[model samples]
Target: MDEKKPSRMYFIGKKEDLIQAKRTTVTLDGRDILLLYHQRTFYAMDLQCYHAGSTLETGDMEEINSKLCIVCPKHKYKITLAEGEGLYKATNPTEKVPTPRWYSKGIKQRVHKVTEVDEDIFVSVSTCPVWIESDYYQSEKGRAELKKAQESGDAEADVNADEDV
Candidate 1:
């Protein structure tokens, strides 16, 4: 039998802080990240919006479609909380047709795994979504990189893919 090593966890704050702020910012691994509490659940995500790099900590939070969404201050892009995907398609109401679709879909924010231990909040910074872990390695570039890494047995290439919820 083999035991897996645990991911590095950085202490964010006490559970009380999460309860008080509902949303707060914390610095872990020298990166500023946001900790959000919604519906009695805790979530940690990147501070910057993936769409236009707007500071997500200062963006507006809304509950839509039974999910938590954040409106990017820069372009009003609605990003979901859990998966960090866009809650709505990026469509400009002013134009009959929105700008030519780019990048396939709305930008996805990078999120970290959150855990509660002893009434404290800890997050693993190195882990992120699949796309982000590959550094947004999409299309042909992404496929080639993933294949090469896998053939070479580069474990880090699939780091995020192994994280547990």
Candidate 2:
């Protein structure tokens, strides 16, 4: 949390900048992390939507199932702020009491730890292997392949592409 960066922690930017913008994307150790400020708390997660790689920095915020969540602008996938849990409501209109049930996709998105120090902020990428699912969070090769696939009209390729080493 201090000016002396820790072994894992990486300096992101000034806290004042985040306070003004509300949301930002920072490249830490190679990953694009989305840092959000909502209700006086800081939330950090993958910068792109886990479902389809849409930029989450442009997403909207709302409360879902008593938890703060970011609604993906592209597909409206609601992801919890505190934890990277994916939320979805199961619609079963044929039940005795027709209602929707919320379920977790088991942390489809990756999140990191954030620390604040005076006017500065730092982030440490999660050690969980879940982040490896991202096309190229750790390198540019996966990103280039993803971009090439996207440009070639191969929508399914992105889903099957391997992570960059």
Candidate 3:
């Protein structure tokens, strides 16, 4: 006897709207997501880019080598809409950091589920938390102290007081 596999379902977009357009944006549980229709199949992924948290819904779409591609507006991270690949690349020290390394280190990679029912489409509502290492924790503490000092305006005063009159 074969074991039955668990079925998953998510609501993405109206079938009519998807039929008219290749892509659509839907908000589920306060999380922004994008629905892509290709070859009569649906794919869903987080709207925010892993690189810079830019909304993929507002990003441009292109067809490369017969595959649909989504480009991040903030960093131009190219992702294939068909299989949801290239969404997140591993962090390398050689790569330029747009944001603080600590915050960037906490950016986790994710792949969401996509499903279609009748005329509507849906994506699974789930997010995975990134684990912070010792360096990340220490960096966060330093940043918090710097932020507090800046907010209090004490850091600026100390810097000016050190300058020659």
Candidate 4:
């Protein structure tokens, strides 16, 4: 099977700075994103848990059945790295999980597309939580504004470096 690639990249941080099993939360374009690194793979998801809207940044990272899963701190719901369906089962195994005749899949969380370039972590803007309703970057004006902000941030970093010298 061929692996899927991210459509776009948004810089997160240096690869060396990310620690395994540590959750990082970042808000970009008014959308909250949760980042988790485990076994050299970076998983990106919405900050809100599917179960009860709990912040997944505070969830517990665990390795279950050789798969990386996040246990929601509020209800102990577990979500897997590949697919986010293990939560319901882990939390309530005694109850019969309802499923439609057409589909038997359990509750699943949306996983954002992530990519790493060199040492920098990037996430696809299309998969960003904010763009779910309507893509904020679809308009040329929005793209231009984002570009300007990135350029300004770069210039500011350069100025700071010069001041330190």
Candidate 5:
């Protein structure tokens, strides 16, 4: 079994200082998260908007129709800071990687939570759990057979032939 490395936590501003600070940006693992202190509680979220990767920290935080909307500086994309969902349901192609159409449909953005421990704040930076494929796919013979089927353009026939002979 492989051992997982624990995430390192850094101490930002104190609880008292956070209340006085309107909006403070903290860098964690090369990613920036804006910290907003409201009602004696601290809320932290991604500084960049998912729509066009616009910096959301500099945007105005106002209530529109009883909903908190963070207006994007680039395209004026109104995104809800509470729910982390963009107002307009538009699929903008990411500059980093092209996502499959099926996978991107009805996808909601995720906002990570920050926990206040003692006097310091901690954010979980662990990677997703690894999923293992089937035992056949893990074997060397299965890889060779898959390669042969791909090269010959007889994947279905090879799979069926292997079961019989």
Candidate 6:
């Protein structure tokens, strides 16, 4: 098996600080990233929604399909904490099932690994090419880069074509 090298980790802040703040938006390399502390675990992801440019720091966390998800306050889109997978409950129009089935939109959010050492917290951006990129990345050049990535088969296809704190 091939082993991958670890991504560079950026120092966030003290775990105590996150525990007190619950959620925080940090600037990394001039880009805003959101850090969330919930259920005794830490999560780091893009600061804004992948669908629209709304903030995710105010988003509510809920369990969907047995996965911890952050529901966007502006549009109610559910994004998972484990790997930033986007999920939507789908219902059968013909059948009479009351509960809707969940489907994956295939990682629509860019998530990072959070590590805690004693009292300090650090975050490492995912090495994979994620589908969930927004903010300044939505510019013309950014879109062109995205297009190139898609053409190179690095970008995942979308269900509805669509992140997180």
Positional deviation of residue 109's Cα in model 4 after best superposition, in angstroms: 1.3
Candidate 3 per-residue lDDT, tens place, 1-165, comes to 112433345555578788678777766654456776667766667665544344566678776556576776656666676555553334456767743221112323244576666666667644334321111212445346445756897431122223211
Q: What is the lDDT of residue 155 in candidate 4?
A: 17
Q: Count the backbone clashes (under 3 Å) in each candidate.
A: 0, 0, 7, 0, 0, 0
Candidate 3: where are CA atoms >4 Å away? 1-8, 63-67, 87-109, 126-165
TM-score for candidate 1, residues paired by index: 0.62
TM-score of each: 0.62, 0.78, 0.49, 0.58, 0.51, 0.74
Clashing pairs in 4: none
What is the TM-score of candidate 5?
A: 0.51
- The sequence of per-residue lDDT tens digits that candidate 4 reaches over residues 4-70 is 5335567888877866436688766455678888777888876665543445787778876566788
Cα lDDT for residue 66, model 4? 68
lDDT of 1 by residue, 4-113 (tens): 44568988789987788888887675556788887788887877655434466667888766667777665676777777766553456688777743222444676778
lDDT for residue 101 in candidate 4, whole number 0-100: 28
What tens digits encode model 6's per-residue C-alpha lDDT throughout 74-118? 678889988888888777788866667888888777777899888
Candidate 4 weakest ten by summed lDDT = 156-165
Candidate 6: segments with Cα more than 4 A from true spot: 1-6, 94-99, 130-165
Give the winner by lDDT: 4 or 5.
4
lDDT of 3 at 162: 32
Greater TM-score among 4 and 6 belongs to 6
What's the ranking of the predictions by TM-score, best on top?
2, 6, 1, 4, 5, 3
In model 2, what lDDT does residue 124 have?
84
Which pairs clash in model 6?
Answer: none
lDDT, model 2, position 89: 84
The candidate, 2 or 5, that scores higher on TM-score is 2
Candidate number achieving the greatest lDDT relative to the actual structure:
2
**Cα-based lDDT at residue 5, candidate 5:** 54
Cα lDDT of model 2 by residue, 23-112, tens digit: 888887777889998998888897877765767888889898799999977668888888878888886878888787887877777778
